[model samples]
Target: MDASLEIRPAAAADAEAVAALLTDFNGEPVDGPTAARRLAALQGIETVLLALRDGAAVGLCSLRVVPFLSADHPYAEVTELYVAPEHRRQGIARRLMREAEALARAQGAPSVYLLTGFQNETAQAFYRSIGYGDYALAMRRRLI
Candidate 1:
């Protein structure tokens, strides 16, 4: 990570920058209000960590803590992780994951998990390098 980079929780004031980064993550243009709404909706159970460089948001990670009936404690899942293309390779993503894990533990989650698309070879490699392994298949159904 760069010496000047700062990592912190996303605040309502950061909605615009955070939304812009999220737009990059989704490969679409996200308007400010829509992004602000989504961020507002994630107020409690989800934590969005922002990596800032020189006061601009350059990266973000979203972790969700949820209760699990099958487990003795709540678990956390990394739902989104993205670093600006220009900021890649500087260890920002790793720092974000580390912070997310710490936050999860502090929130009483025993473990944190994430899923990278099988086709995202780069992400898979990164996850493996960081000690994540195959666990189980994630199946989903589209209700819409």
Candidate 2:
């Protein structure tokens, strides 16, 4: 981590930057209002960890805590993780993941999981390097 870089929880004021980062992740534009609403909706059960460099948001990781019928404690799912193209390979993503995991632990979550596109080999390698292993296949259904 850079000495000037800081990682902290996202705030209402971060709507624009967060939205921009999310847009990068989704490969689409996200308007400010929509991003604000999404962030507000995740206020309680989820957390967005932001990495700032010189007071600018550079990266983010969103974590959601959920209950599981088979577990004594709730588990956490990492819904999103992104870093600016200019900031890649700087350990920002790893730092954000660590912070998100720490928050999940503080919330009594027993484990944390995440999913990435099958074609994203770089992401898969990174996750594996960080000790994350595949436990099961992820299936999804689109209702729209």
Candidate 3:
């Protein structure tokens, strides 16, 4: 872990920075207020972790315990993982993943799952390096 970094539960007050960080990694602008509201709801009912460095928010990841309908185990879904561009390659994301896994286990999750676009080779490599395997197929429908 980075000496100056701290990984903790995300709070409503960190919304704007978290939203902006998401937008930056996602390549779009997100309405801070809307994002904040969503984050508030998730915080109340789920686990969303944030990475802070020197008291500034720089990374965020979402982990939710989701049940496997046909299986006996409930697994964790690592939804969004992001690190500020300046903080990349510094193990910030890796630390966040470790935190997420710990959180998942605490929530009684038997496994952790994640998905990435087929062309997102970089993210795929990262996930694989972190010991995630490709077991499920991710399908999506574009409503736009």
Candidate 4:
């Protein structure tokens, strides 16, 4: 880990930085006000781990722990993980994953799950390198 790197849970005050990071990751603009409101609304229900280097936002990972009666423990879902293009391959994402797993452990979750595009070979390789396997395909149905 870099001495200047910090991995911490995000708060309402971080919305703009998070939004800026998201925009860089997604190539789309995200409204700061809306993101702030959503982040506030999702408080307690979600965990948005932010990675900062020298106090500048460098990456983020968003996760949620969910309970299901069929399981002995809750499962964690990491919805998004991103590192700025300039910040990639510096182990920032790995650090984020470690923190996410730590959050899962603290939340009584036995596993962490996430979805990546099937065609995203780079991400697939990265996940595989980190001890994650392709267990199931994710299918979505839009109701809108």
Tens digits of per-residue lDDT for model 4 on 1-144?
499999999988898998998888889998788779878887776899999999998999998887878898887899999999999999999999999999999999988899999899999999999999988888989999
Per-candidate TM vs. native?
0.95, 0.96, 0.90, 0.96
Model 2 C-alpha lDDT per residue in residues 1-144, reported as the tens digit of each score: 389899998988899999899888889999778888988999888899999999999999999997879888988999999999999999999999999989999999978899999999999999999989998899989999
CA shift at 73, candidate 2, in angstroms?
0.2
**2 or 3, greater by TM-score:** 2
Q: Each model's C-alpha lDDT?
A: 0.91, 0.91, 0.85, 0.91
Candidate number with the higher TM-score (1 or 2): 2
Model 2: which ten-residue window has the lowest total lDDT? 30-39
**Off by more than 4 A, model 3:** none
Q: Give the lDDT of residue 86 in candidate 1.
A: 99
What is the Cα-based lDDT of residue 46 in candidate 4?
80
Q: Could you tell which candidate, 1 or 3, scores higher by lDDT?
A: 1
- The predicted structure with the larger TM-score, 1 or 3, is 1
Task: Report the CA-based lDDT of candidate 1 relative to the real structure.
Answer: 0.91
Candidate 4 deviant stretches above 4 angstroms: none
